[model samples]
Target: MKSSAATDNSSHHVKCDKNNINDDGNNSFIELPPNSRPLEHQIAGHFYDQSKTKYGLLQHSNGDVLKPLLNPPRGPCEEQFYIDVFCQTSKSKYNSEDLINLRKFLPHYLGTYKCQKMSYIILENIIQPFKHPCITDIKIGRITYDKEANEEKIHRMSKNSVVAEIGFQLSGWKIYRSKYYEYHDKRCVRSLNKTDILHGIAYFYGAPIHLRLDVIELVINKLNELQDYMKQQHTFVLISSSLMVVYEGDDNDQELNKSTFVDVRLIDFAHVFPQTNSNQSDENFLFGLANYIDYMKQLLDKNYVYVPIDKFEHDNKTDTKIYSCYKQLLT
Candidate 1:
């Protein structure tokens, strides 16, 4: 519901009229509607960094999202990745089950949009189905920096040592509870221990017991589907990507729609690259997925009380059965 203020970068300015967008041959690239605004609930990726851009995703009038392409190779690489997965043609070579089934776990790619010499990738808004959505962005993979990372970038990422310890990090989350939303940004979890992270996850799915059970179970099922796809493929090394978990946060019984209750999708593919060799799967991504799944299963197995984050901060020594779930990670 928020609009990004006009930035110094002219490329980011929306200057398209209906005719300019509609004339892009075959009508594949649609124009940004006048009402399009920056997505307010975005949790992860470059969007949150003030210097990256004052804007992130623009929610279109048709309920889709317009994601601006980053500069250079990162932009082109992401565009090509989507094209190879979705726009299958006679000349394309990325048709493996790994790539094909990606649709099951990723936002549907509509097409590319170019306006005033700037480009954007249009994708289905993953949260469109929910009334009030509780969302979390979990960055996957232990080795987040790719071979392309410069020394400075590598040094910066290395400082967040939790990624190497647990194979993933709870980058950010926005939860709706008691008619209000609580947000924890990426910086909050960077230095957290494995136990504190577990508490954070607990706080994420902090719905009423009955609703919490259903949401966690469904989310776990979705993760399993992604896990199955990741295990069988040795195609791309997904780096610095994230698993976006969203669920309906409107707890009213009448508003609860089981069909649209929870959704999971893979997001942020700027660093995704083909594997060095055909025989090796992306173990780094799989390891993170596996660890997250284990944590969810433990939640289902035990009735662990959901501790409010503020309470956890003051008295983290709460002896709940949930802490026993990932004893290995803590040690």
Candidate 2:
């Protein structure tokens, strides 16, 4: 795990000045350090296809991620949320263990970084430890849009039947196997049904049975821990956010010596809202969390292991192998 020492000092807690950031599309004015580059595994968020230098996340040399402050009130909202969670004051009301435990399930916020008048949120790269990380981003909650959303935004979210029916949507996934990274981008995820989503989960953990079980057990435990923390808190509602699940995919068993093999963290807090109208916990997110946990637990049972091979077959990657329970048992 990354150290919190970088954010311990008060100097890192610089207040976000909206005027200082350039949210406009123009990217020529901004200048980044030579050591920084676009985050290679970023699956979602605003991105420029033509220009890698302009938008999206930047990974700094020290292994910290710099996320540009987008247009408000999302930009400001996410910044404040991180501050409340990491830079808690002596008199702050959010100091409860239920909320503070969130640090374990989130990227370490080392405050903000400013460059050439453009502001960015400095965060620890959660996947920095892994040599080959198999990652997936699942957007949580059936109700994706918050109460503050406009009609168009509400309609757009509501139209996503996957989120409405499943309580969660697979945004994108990248798996490492056969010495290659297999990408299932947002466009690919959009075509999947509930069953395909489950298969995708299995595919993510596709490896030797021993390795697969080890990763699944650790991931489920982490999800349960995160769920317990959320159940105890009635302070906030998470909307349009995702749970990023990562595991080492290298053939070498580096995870054996580590405390954990899998890493699950919550990301994309731009739509997080406070629970002001009622004292009820975030049922919208909790419902999704419970459902997600159930799916993960099913993997542990080994009742079934589904692997979508049509894509690989179409690509003529006949040599590539996906682990299946039947295949493992037969061998």
Candidate 3:
């Protein structure tokens, strides 16, 4: 119910309009999470409200992703609901960076609603129309510290963990937070979990074999743009951020030489904090993003016969900048 002052930005200013929200707007807020089956319809309805200038999403007093609604559009686009189990840790108000600093979006945020006991944000579904959509979470970030200590902690937890069959990845990292055995199936709705708040899981959409290079360019360019925007906001994405891509299984026309088109969005904002440790934040995302860029290059090199960088070229400066960043991470 409180709105904090927007952080000073060199290139932009962010503010919330008093007319865009009503403190007593809980009339539309549900008390449960969005996975309780019975409230699915209720939670899904928030995305369709067009009466307001910006859509309302539920949030709490502490800036967590639930129990309160955050309004104010970043651009001329529709407002989006930014919710999840994680809340802002430093201040009393929600970190406006959760939505403002983002360079990509799942879709326009509508408002907030809950299913059963958990709260959920309703927004335009990015993958509803894509066919046979399969999303994989790639936990990306530089492995600077000896992962041995982190891995050991994970090992100890596994020894005392519940024997749930549906959780845990091969590397023992927990990624089952929001897996739908079938993405398009309605029966797979579940509560958001700890991984949603912790892991920087980037969901890469499977693209046709031919267009992999184009897609990788799209991903890289977006990250570069994001880094610039984050710096302007005087905020840095210090934590792990994700890249979610949604694509189709449409015909890979052997004759149509063009790269296949895809829709991609970045998710997860738990580690995105204020600009206190800007240097480290830059290190985390630059190296982390560079690492992902290399991964894609390797995948395309081995699987495809052609690699065309011009499909999404910027300029010589960009190529040098990106390549140089890649070299830094590798060396």
Cα RMSDs, all models: 10.3, 6.3, 16.8
- Candidate 3 residue runs with Cα over 4 Å from true position: 1-107, 143-211, 227-233, 236-240, 253-260, 278-281, 299-331
Model 3, C-alpha of 100: deviation from truth (Å)? 3.3
Could you give the candidate ranking by TM-score, starting with the highest?
A: 2, 1, 3
The CA lDDT at 320 in model 3 is: 46
**lDDT value, candidate 1, whole model:** 0.70
Q: Between candidates 1 and 2, which one is better according to TM-score?
A: 2
Candidate 2, residues 1-331: lDDT per residue as tens digits? Answer: 2465534745253343444434466655344444677776666665533344456688887888888787789987887777777776554445445557677778878878776555788887988887778788988999988888899989988997877877988777777764567666665566667667776677668733333777888888888888888888888889988999988776476555456567899998898876774567888999998998888777777566566544323233332333111111111
Residues 1-331 of candidate 3 have per-residue lDDT tens digits of: 1122122121111233333323355534322222222211112212223224223333332333322223222111111213321222243233455445452443434344433222244334444444433343333344322222477655653452211222221111111112222121111111213332111122222322234455556656655665455445444343434555544434353553234345555544434434565344455555555545544555455443332323122246754443211111111
Q: Deviation in angstroms for 191 in model 1?
A: 4.0
Rank order (by lDDT, best first): 2, 1, 3
Error of model 2, residue 2, in angstroms: 6.0
- TM-scores of the candidates are 0.80, 0.83, 0.42
TM-score of 2: 0.83
Indicate which candidate wins on TM-score.
2
